[model samples]
Target: MTRRNRRMARLALPRLAFLVVPAFLAGCASPPVRFYTLGAPAIATGAVPTGIVTPATPVVEVARVTLPDYLDGQDIVVRAGNQIERSATGRWASRLSLGATDLITAQLARGRTDLFVTDQPQSLPATWRLAVNISRLDVTRDGTASLEADWSIIPHDANLPILHSRAAFTQAGAAATDGDTARLTQAVLEQLAERIVAGWPR
Candidate 1:
């Protein structure tokens, strides 16, 4: 009510406003929540075929593998109803084909057979050629991954596939992550390789 009291009240009001405003701003500026991703594990290499015969004259050659061009052009299907992540380079590197190449390399390194050449020249001496048909390769949110392949091994002189077979394998993973697709891809390749080696003609 007095003049001095009124002056003191007015000064105190400004200080209180300053303190309250800072506190309100600090509360509003809380830190943001963070999210993280997890990657899938490597595919397991199954049992190696038994009773494999070392060739008397091991053929040392690599066959040229042909893949459907569409597989490289199309988006990799990671999961149903989920859009595939485009590479920063705007192209997928043909992961399935890469996997097949890796499989051939691995088999060559096994050292069971002596054949070891990279080129596919018609005149080059090769025991057999590898051809593959990719049926299904997909990752799913249901913690399941699958790969299916139909393959054949034909002798150089023969038009018909000397040996033909199909191999399919699936495994359940916790979720998708880096290299999960690669792992599944490897699984399919390994199975195909095993089948081919097991069914090699005597």
Candidate 2:
């Protein structure tokens, strides 16, 4: 081999080694994934303030909720215009489909004790059934949480007519952190629950 070529090869080896070592170290030091949930804590007995009368019980079942394909995973999704990104180090405590359904049902039950909320078909006859389809539910680059859904309230019995409507809602997140993103999403869902209950027949 020529002396010049041999010298060049030796120099290239050190440069290649320098590039790979840090990448290996970085992979080892990467942070672990953090998980979050939107479910509310159990309400203690008598914790509710006075002067609020409980509404009459309404038997309601929340049918399986449908979410956009983008949010079918455990990772939290965020969007800005045409760009969308999933969290690398933060994730949902439960799958989005199940989590969203439970979150909404719980929120409704909390406000109105007379309402019985369930995710599955219950043996107890339900007077009303709620079905929700979410078109958009994501945090934006500006730290805003937005949700758009088409929801319906149908009489469990086929004889009764159906009530359907659309709701588009948004709320600013607590902060730029992942926890805040989750909190903002929960707040948006609470608003959605309110819209659904407001349509209750007199």
Candidate 3:
């Protein structure tokens, strides 16, 4: 309408545009989150056995699974020269401890349907219980996922009196992409499962 009013309107337009443009750009620039599981596709196909057995195997309970302080967070963590960085867009579908427990249960039950494996507290009498503590689990810049853990199994009761064994191990993951770190992590867990089964009383 007036000359002064027109000048004020022009000045306001640039300020409004400056504020709005950045907000719009930030929204567009922000990355979308990509969630991943600990295992499945990355592990070798048919590596897990199939088919149910005639006699059901003993009930096994996953008592507890723990992770290192650095890896206890929700984000996908990578280690570089003793510095750990969390991925802004890459993340785990669930907690690493829970994922590890689930992966361990699946790997053990893959071939042996007879064995009833569970993560919850045993309602019925549990013949065996497993506890695992992971010290270091992270994907590095070198394209390798590594896992270090200690685990043990305890039998409720046995005529043969199975001895409790405590073992610690370090396993390397094989994966082509950084995004496939979960797969490599799963492979490491499979190796841990095999070790536990090997020590089970026959």
Candidate 4:
């Protein structure tokens, strides 16, 4: 209404706009992070075989599954040319080691009827222990994933020998989206599981 009041209102408008700009930029810079899990697509699922149970059947325990320190974290890792980088908007649902162990254990249990496999703490002594150490795990935005690991199956009997081996897997698919990257990873892990089962000693 008054001249002084009109000028003051115009000055206040610029100050309010400046204050709002920073908050808007912050929101745009940070998007909601999505979580993914390894071996979630169920590519290697099998119904557990049922039959007359035998006490002589062996139980294999997953002693441990470990990944490189950088790859063990929750962030989704990607290979960008020669450098490795973490995804900005995606993360692993659980630590890579735990997820990998669970995936392998579940498959091993259902894949064979003559043997049992578990990662849980067992009260009864296990006949065999399996240890896996992952040295390399990476995925590209283009949907190619690679995994390299060394593993061993050790017998509880001191006189028995251990079986040690290394495996590498490469999986390619549509990986431009985060979900696609996750599925690509699942494919890699599924292949790894199949490799492990094939190596299991009869």
Query: Alpha carbon lDDT of residue 127, candidate 3?
Result: 77
Model 3 per-residue lDDT tens digits across residues 2-58: 999999999999999999999999988967788888763232321324444333457
lDDT of predicted model 4: 0.80
Best by lDDT: 4
Q: In model 1, what is the error at residue 156, expressed in angstroms?
A: 2.4
Clashes of each: 9, 1, 1, 0
- Could you give candidate 1's per-residue lDDT for residues 1-202 as a string of tens digits? 9999999999999999999999999998845432211111232222123334343443434444446554434244455565444322122344446546546544543524334323234454566666667676666656576767776766766664567787777776654543455455455556656665566554
Against the reference, the lDDT scores of all candidates come to 0.52, 0.76, 0.68, 0.80
lDDT tens per residue, model 4, 68-184: 888887877778888877788999899878888878887777666678667876788889998988898788877789999889989989899999999899988887877887788
Relative to the unseen true structure, what is the Cα RMSD of model 2? 6.8
Clashing pairs in 1: 39-177, 59-115, 60-115, 60-116, 60-117, 61-115, 61-116, 61-117, 62-117
Top-scoring candidate (TM-score): 4
What's the TM-score of each model vs. the native? 0.54, 0.75, 0.75, 0.80
* Candidate 2 per-residue C-alpha lDDT over 122-198 given as tens digits, one digit per residue, 9 for 90 to 100: 77667788899999898886888889999888886898889889989999855467777778888887788778767
